[model samples]
Target: MRRSREGYEIYPVADAIGGISPTAHDNAMQRMIQAGAQPVNAISLVAELQRDWGRARADELRSILRWYFPKLQEIRAQN
Candidate 1:
């Protein structure tokens, strides 16, 4: 497995979104979609959206994070 600078193991984040149990994956997708439905015209809103998804899917959160990173990154870059 690849390792991050902080020494965390780095399996492909995308893998989490793909092969997870279907019920978990679908739940994550729905949360991600909801998080993404908000206006991203401001950084606070983007942060809130990210936090919302992270909290909503805390048990298996990375799937949503994987699905929405690009959009979230774009919003973060604006801050």
Candidate 2:
């Protein structure tokens, strides 16, 4: 993940999920594929499974405020 001064600072999904290393994420994704999980990236999985701001979206809108504002107070610490 690159850290830009004016753009989004990308983070590894595995890191967000369970602090798993890159190698681990790769292995996990591979295992998931073998297990028939559509071969999605870790980031996508996090965005799908993580319920942020009381409004979890099919997309990665956890960073979007307007749609997730309702659960801000409760999830701020987690954020």
My TM-score estimates for the predictions, one after another, are 0.24, 0.31
- Show model 2 residue runs off by greater than 4 Å: 1-19, 40-79
Clash count per candidate: 0, 0
Residues 1-79, model 1: lDDT tens digits: 3344576643222323443587886666555445442222333444455676547555465555566778777988999
Models, CA RMSD each:
16.6, 13.3
Give the total clashing residue pairs for model 2.
0
Clashing pairs in 2: none
